[model samples]
Target: MSGPPPAAVTVHAPLRRRVTVQGVVQGVGFRPYVHALATALDLSGNVTNTPEGVVVEVEGDPAAVARFCDRIAVDAPPLARVDSVHHQEVPATGDSAFTILASRADGPTRALIPPDTATCAACLGELADPRDRRHRHPFVTCTHCGPRFTIVTGLPYDRDQTTMAGFPMCAGCAREYTDPADRRFHAQPVACPDCGPRLALLVRRADEAGQPSPVTDGDPIAAARRLLAGGAVLAVKGLGGYHLACDATDPAAVERLRHRKARGDKPFAVMAASVEDIEPLVRLDPEERALLTATTRPIVLLRRRTDGPTVPGGLRPAEGVAPGSPDFGIMLPYTPVHHLLFGLPGDPEGPRLLVMTSGNLSGEPIVTDDAEALERLAHLADAWLTHDRPIHVPCDDSVVRVCDGRPLLVRRARGYAPLPLPLPLEVRPALAVGGDLKNAFCLGAGRRAWLSAHIGDMDDLATQRAFERAVAQLESITPVRPRLLAADRHPAYRSARWAVRNAAGRPVVRVQHHHAHVAAAMAEHGLDGSVPVLGVAFDGTG
Candidate 1:
């Protein structure tokens, strides 16, 4: 009786669709990832970066379209972590093929900005190849990986909007950057040895023309190794800003850097060579190692090793690194220069890692300019290990710790800021002037919150200028024009004054400092504020 069961029925409709893939898409290798997928599925569409997310108008075989839309998150790049993909049928414009278009500026910016990533394996191989023009070049990078938030002045992350603007790519690099097949395709920071950021060794001389010292000898790596081994202080320019470094093993030099910076009892952070170096210094399980080696390159605060013998004393490597803090802020090198710094000639054994800290006194912003660093940190550092690469924006180092089983942001700077924080309420255009200490600004519209990089504090004229600059630069990226400004009610808070002074037509909302902190947490936790909340208040004013 069931001879033919039932005739199979197929439903077919020529449907076109528009897909918006959101959450952490920009600078996390989303375009290339989508490009590969679109090509694989034989889709006829174009993908572009809008403020909210990647916009894709795919028109193809319905089955392939389904797979292309659904499988994106599953097949995302190792660095790209997609949170959601929304697809809806739309009137199709008959396009022949799928193309990745340049990012658009007017759309909603609900997507997160990605932090600077570590050098990719491909770039690393080329770093050592003599035939490669980028051989031993410290700033080698590609589209898949390189500096992101820190170096970027505005969004749509083109070379023109980056620190790489001054040093345009040469003919050879131009070809590579243009080629979709090449790794450097759309790499904003692409450069060759011919047209690239170069390093310079500086000494504080009476005249500017007086040649300090050329770091470029037969081998700059070897030269850096020699310079570092001699117990001299080196002021190094890094991802976030400038760093003052000294031999960790040499107590005297470490002591000197600490004293000169007027950082009396504060802890000094140490940059280690490997997880092996990290293990001997701090107790680490697999989780700690994983966090340390994460692409963010944040300063992971770890518990000090109580049992290790020959531990450096009151140099207090652990305590000094995170002064007045409960954890030790440790990090590994994130750049090729760092890799080669540790990989010196003959494999010398003088503790490859050193004490690396912000090149400034406590409570000040990081020094970016060589002349400024020399003038400000002259007494702090004996010598300088600077590069000619001009820093477009100032971004301090990010410090993190696992608190209450979650990654707590102690110092959110270069690696973490400018990323859009998903907001709970879709509020009007508003600017939140963050706490004066560990200062940053949050500009919000709809569900997106664009946080400025670490702007030191609202204390000095320099920091105030920096805050203004960061605000101006970030305003260029977002579509929102703030209608209101928010600041802490603290009497002496300079941010409050700045908000009052600068927000001309906007009314300022005065939120209590600790209340804002609690509110921020409650927002992230998705807790309703209608009911009365209980909490222990640590106002720090007994």
Candidate 2:
């Protein structure tokens, strides 16, 4: 009876797996996502950030473990770029719950640092909501967005390794940071108004002998708005470096900035609050509009409309903003500070459009040090709107243009640097010190090459120092230790000279200028270089 007592019921043993995930995983909420996934599948596991990448160990039913492994890459966090995932079966640990462990630092660092991202919509909502605790917080950021490359000082990206190290979390933020259910969980730069960086407005006081004096009486943002409304240039400290901001609608202000910087009629980029704000000034196809509002928020070149809308007092983007140019380089607000600069609704109206140019003198690096900014930009800026946070590296704004319905990079920095490009064929480790102009160097190993952010021309000692610092920083996080060096063949090139000087007995390969240009194009298109191809090179000299 009853089929011989159900044939003596049998149970299968639990399965466990140890997994390793690499690529853009450290700072982008990968651990929280992993914890959530494991918990949802009723599995027990621990996830942690390591110098190498993210690692996870899970024990559960065989089917559930397989699902966990599959979803780790397929449904990773929005900002995470999971390049590879590996998992192997191991003995079950019988752990009761899933957890996120502190980052492990004892290893060779191969983790990819994420580029700084524009503020996400959720943070922007909190910024605008009066009922929210972070209302009007200039540093509103979550794990999804905000500073990464520029703020990172070391690997296994943690709060202590970032510029936010000095700003200890308050009780409320700490609660949010440790709770896996919360969005701010393990967000390195998480902060609230109660315990975060404060904004300060500085101006050169005649009584202080041209020294910058902080304004302690009124709100800094409101005071800054007034300065721009009065056609005064402001040196505003940003995520990476200082920006020289002025009312783009004011012709005198634009001309004053150009004259002060000795800019020779080169086009100046402008920042508006939204696409709608700039729609009247530029022709925006769907692709161009998407690019203008992308999370990276690069300066996009758009065809200018000759007959565009004018502001009150018949003010438009001044001719001095982009003299003799058919297009306007424009970008939307990328940071909470930038959004606050353009006032929120129901606040006093300020400059809806701003000339946000790099804060630098002619042929020099952008100013990152606050004291240095106060000294170097004193002659150019009428006021300084800065904060207490220190930028570890100087990154400039990236520039882009839409060509044939695709995004074409003109100057790759800020949003897109230190991200590796895949090579069609594997090659030995090497370091390429780029030309003297637009000196972004490269570090290559195997089939990948990592390019540094936009380091300025090598003519200035300051720029050369920046290049060296960037090279060292890039090498610290990557596995590439160059055994060979490449430089331009031009003997007078500063980049070449620096490469030869620092070769450390490694052979230095000199590449011809035009030939290198062709090779670069070929590499970009994934050509193997096995077949002969015709190439044409043209530049100012040619």
The most accurate candidate by TM-score is 2
lDDT of 2: 0.90
Q: What lDDT would each prediction earn against the true structure?
A: 0.74, 0.90
Q: Which regions in candidate 2 have their CA more than 4 angstroms from the true location?
A: 1-10, 307-315
Question: How many steric overlaps does candidate 2 have?
Answer: 0
- TM-scores, in order shown? 0.87, 0.97
Q: State the weakest 10-residue window (summed lDDT) of model 2.
A: 1-10
> Candidate 1 residues 397-427, lDDT tens each?
7788876667877766656666677777778
Q: State candidate 1's TM-score.
A: 0.87
Write candidate 2's Cα lDDT for 1-542 as tens digits: 44555466666688999999999998899999998999999999799888989999999888899899889999999889988998898888899999988889988878899999999999999999999999999999999999999999998899999999999999999999999999999999999999998899988775546577789998899899999999999999998899999999899999999999998989999998778778778788999888878889999999988785554445478889999999999999999999999999889877888999999976688899998998889899999999998899789999999888889888888888768999988888999999888778999999999988788878999899989988998998888999999999998999999999999999999999888888878888899799898989985321
